[model samples]
Structures are given as C-alpha cells and as structure tokens.
Target: MPGTTTLWRPTGPAELDLVAASGWREWPPRLPEQPIFYPVLNVDYAIKIARDWNVPHSGAGFVTEFDVDTDFVSRYPVQQAGGRDILELWVPAEELPEFNRHIVGTIRVTHTFPETA
Candidate 1:
C-alpha cells in the first residue's frame, strides 16, 4: 500500500452487492444515467453520505475502503463539493475499467447501516 492512496466510498445495498459479486475486487459499471464514479477522500464524508443519504433513499447504506495507485488517481484532481472535508475524485464512467485496474487490493466494507423501523 505504499504507492497507493486510501479511498472511501458510500454505497447503497445494490452497489455493495455488486462489489461483493466481484469478490470485492472491482466496481460495477456506472448505469446509463450515472456519469461519474466518485470515491471520497475521507471516511467521514463517506459515512455521512451512507448514513444521511443512502440509508434514507436506498433503505441500506455501507462504507467501503480500498487503496488505489496514487499515480493513477492523481490524474483526477481532488474535488471539493461543499466544505473543506467534502473531497472526492471523479472518474469518468468510460475510464472506470482502467481505474479498476489501479486498485491495489480488495475492497472492504467497513461499516453497514440497515433499514430501521
């Protein structure tokens, strides 16, 4: 992991299932309406999205962490969506396969949020 940067992703159950289906090695292709595959730079931002957004909208949420080659990820500049900690990298959909190649290790589900009554 020396040459890699750790990244966190906020995932809904459907997407988490897909990642699991890949044996935790790859991210599924973006859907037609989805243009970019974004991974956040911080776990806190990832957790916020998973807890506040994905849970309400998707009924379940997850936070995943993985490492990507620093050189490959550096091609996309870090984007700050709102606040200082809201940082992410936006990889175009078409480049995702190549981006997947730069992933250094298996993805892990660090946290999971299930629907609550």
Candidate 2:
C-alpha cells in the first residue's frame, strides 16, 4: 500500500450491482451521458452524498472505498467542487478503463444507507 491512495465513491444500487458483477475488482464503464468518474477524498463526503442524495433518488446508496496506484491517479488534479472538504478527482469518462486498471485491490463497501430507524 505504499504507493497507493484510498478513494471513496458514493454509488447507487445499479452501480453497486455492476461492481459486484465485476467480482468487486473494478468499476464499470460510465454510460454515454456520464462525462466523468469522480472519487472523493474523504469518507465523510462520501457518506453525505450516499445518504442525502443517492438514497433519496435511487432508493438505496452505499459508500465504497478502494485503493489505486498513486502515480496513475496523479494524472488528474484534485477538484474542490464545493466546501473545503468536498474534494474529489474527476477522471474523464474515456479514461475510466485505464483508471480501473490501476485499482490496487478489491473495492469494499464501507457504509450503506437506510440504517435502522
């Protein structure tokens, strides 16, 4: 793990299914309308989106964490989309295949929405 960085991605059930179908090794390619594949820098940011947005819109949500080769991911600069904590890397849709190849290990679900209430 020395040359790797961990990233989090908030995903819906459909995307999660695709990830599972990949044997949890890689992410699925983005759809034509999707222009970028974004992975957040922190767990808090990932949790917020998965709980507040994905659950509401897609009926379920999850926060996934994975490691990627640091050098490979360095190609894209970190993007601060909103608050100081809202940090993410935007990999162009076309480059996601290459991005997937850089994943260091299995993707894991760190959190899931709709907690017992």
Candidate 3:
C-alpha cells in the first residue's frame, strides 16, 4: 500500500463530466444494456480504446486517472485476452460505489482523444 498506486479508466466525455459533476465521488449508473464497469490497467490501452473506439463513435473520448486501494481492487478478477495487454477489472454496476470508496483522489481526465483524425 505504501508504494503501490492508481488505476485508469478510458471513457467518453459524457462519463468524465458525470464524474466531475458528482463531486468527484461516484461513477454514473450503467445503462440497462451495460452490465460492467471496466477500469483498464495501463494508459496505453486506455488511450487506444479511447481513440479508436470511444472518440470515433461518441465524438469525444477521455481517459480518467484515479487512485484506489490495491487491496480493494485485488478482490475482483482481472481479465486478459491474447496480445492486448488489457488487464482490467469487471466491476458490476451494483458494486460501483464500493469500488469508488477505494479511490483516493478526484478522477481527472488525463487525455482527450482524436489527437489526430
């Protein structure tokens, strides 16, 4: 806990605004069709998703950085596919606040997408 630190989430601009407006405390509720909240492990993966996926479709993409208790995060499972280096947790909508409580600081938008094209 001493040296260990933050996790990052890549999302659309709408979600970032929601996080900011909610007093930097909670994540917005997931839509009916959406069941999981994914906070990726690395900025590169986050940026890739934000740029290639979120920005093109949503018109605005954002990467959010925050600190969470690694112990709390360790309680969940991590998903990793073949070559993606996409380590992430699948936090269910109902458990979001529980996850949020571990977050140490205000989630800030680290990057905005479409740096080109």
Number of the top candidate by lDDT? 1
Expressed as tens digits, the lDDT of each residue in 3-94 for candidate 2 is 99999999999999999999998999999899999999999999999999999888888999999999999999999999999999999999
Per model, state how many residue pairs clash.
0, 0, 0
The 10 consecutive residues of candidate 2 with the worst lDDT sum are 108-117
TM-score of candidate 3 versus the correct structure, residues matched by position: 0.88
* Model 1: per-residue Cα lDDT at residue 19: 94
Comparison by lDDT, 2 against 3, better one: 2
Off by over 4 Å in 3: 1-4, 114-117
Q: List the residue pairs that clash in candidate 1.
A: none
Full-model lDDT, candidate 3: 0.81
Number of the top-ranking candidate, with TM-score as the measure = 1
RMSD of each: 1.0, 1.6, 2.0
By descending lDDT, how would the candidates be arranged?
1, 2, 3
Models sorted by TM-score, best on top: 1, 2, 3
Error of 2 at 98 (Å): 0.5
Runs of candidate 2 exceeding 4 Å displacement: 115-117
